[model samples]
Target: MDAALFAKSLLLGLAIAAPLGPIGALCINRTLERGILAGLAGGLGTALADGVYASLAAIGFAAFSDALARIDMPLRLLGGAFMLWLGVREMRPAPPRAPAPVRPRDLLGTTASTFLLTITNPMTILAFAALFAGLGLAATSSNADAALVVAGVFTGSMLWWCCLSGGVALARHRLPPAFARWVARLSGAILIAFGLAALLTALA
Candidate 1:
């Protein structure tokens, strides 16, 4: 159908997901700590959420999106609390030893954790709405066109994660245990600060 429109939406998705925010930090941390698969799991979760938001925007679900926004404060609070907990868990001391086996549950856990983290920010929908409107793909787009664009969004987001995780996995062997530990703690501190800021904003 509209290949140009689909390509634009794909780029939009890449731009949205490219930011090195909390999710990016988490993915990198997991990649370094575990392996490439673990990192990709985290990315997959966020990508799925992006797809969900993009789908809503493509379908022009204005009313439903607005309804989610109404509880934005609560969602932020929940997300902040979870981040704090996750940061604390990451900071927990671990013996310098061999890496543990990557279980199916661990991948699922990473996926679930990132998914929860991404979806809590209802602002993502607003972002998609604004972006889609700007691109003239929200209300005016045909169902077929919207579907293609949404698929492109998912592909673009997933591609970013794959690249990030792959890079981190390659570097994992170069990092010493002590350095990895420091990175973990530093990431924890950053996450804690982010959590506090979000919590304070919610209270305000």
Candidate 2:
């Protein structure tokens, strides 16, 4: 086990996941509306997607990489559309209610939705490729090293999500319902803006 390699990968994952993008907003909203577990589930989905992208980048599979690149525009469009739908849904007014208990089905659906959202972003693969190359893990890493990198990335991403969700959950327990509602609306607006940006970029 290359401890240094693992450590670097872990930090890389944390850095990549730390940005509060649309995905982060979704997770935070879910945390406030559902619970910590639901938010963590969403994070797990994103972590898994990151792991998949990392593996694909590390393996240097030319065919797979090329295919992903070829479909980049379409993927972006789909992602943008999905984000818009989600944003509108989030912005919809809901009756004041207690946080729902996390059920297996709910977790599964949340995880699947987040995973799809993350995976659809074609730039994720490019980002992983660029980062791996920057870190000197591009051409020379062995199979074991690649595996470790994937594991480290997954673990690190999950760690960030866990911390974020926990903190938000604590606030959820204390904050008034109006605060949550306002936050949800803000998150939805952010998501809508991001979706518009993505769509325009794809079209351009």
Candidate 3:
């Protein structure tokens, strides 16, 4: 793998993952509710999902790609519905105390949930495919290069999650219960909006 190519991939991956979207919001919420480890696990899950999609794109599996494309809209609809449900759940009233402290099981659950959510988005795969094709990444023709690209993606994702979690944590104490509730509601609303937009695009 060329050093320049690896650096380029790393930068591009970071650029793509830095956006604060549904996943980022979820990571921040988890970090505040649980801890930094929980958020990191969630970020790792998303990064792994991205790597999987990238690998698939690098291999140029046409049949699988076409199948994913065919079902992308349905998948997007399902994702949107799930996000809406999550938003509604977040908007509900809660008790006046923090929930249980973070545990190993909590970490595992958080990681798995985020991983499943990220991986099930067929649009992500298509996005990776288009990016790989546009960047001529497949021309590298080396598993090591592919691995490096995956590492870059993982690093970039982790960086974003860490920054978000840290930033949220910094202000967590200052925010009262009421403020936290509003924050949750606002984040949930944004997530729902993104989901709706994605659904509309898929339908169109």
Candidate that would win on TM-score: 2
Residues 156-179 of candidate 3: C-alpha lDDT, one tens digit per residue: 666777777777777777778676
Ranked by TM-score, the better of candidates 1 and 3 is 1
Candidate 2 wrongly placed segments (more than 4 Å) = 61-65, 122-126
Q: What is the lDDT of residue 80 in candidate 1?
A: 83
Weakest lDDT window of 10 consecutive positions for candidate 3:
91-100
Clashes of each: 0, 0, 0
Candidate 1 lDDT score relative to the true structure: 0.78
Measured over all alpha carbons after superposition, the RMSD of each candidate to the real structure, in angstroms, is 2.2, 1.8, 2.7
For each candidate in turn, the TM-score is 0.88, 0.92, 0.82
lDDT of 2 at 58: 66
Question: Could you tell me the TM-score of candidate 3?
Answer: 0.82
Q: Please give the ranking of all candidate structures by TM-score, highest first, separated by commas.
A: 2, 1, 3
lDDT of model 3 at residue 137? 66
* Superior candidate under lDDT, 2 versus 3: 2
Q: Residue 45 error for model 2, in Å?
A: 0.6
Which residue pairs in model 2 clash with each other?
Answer: none
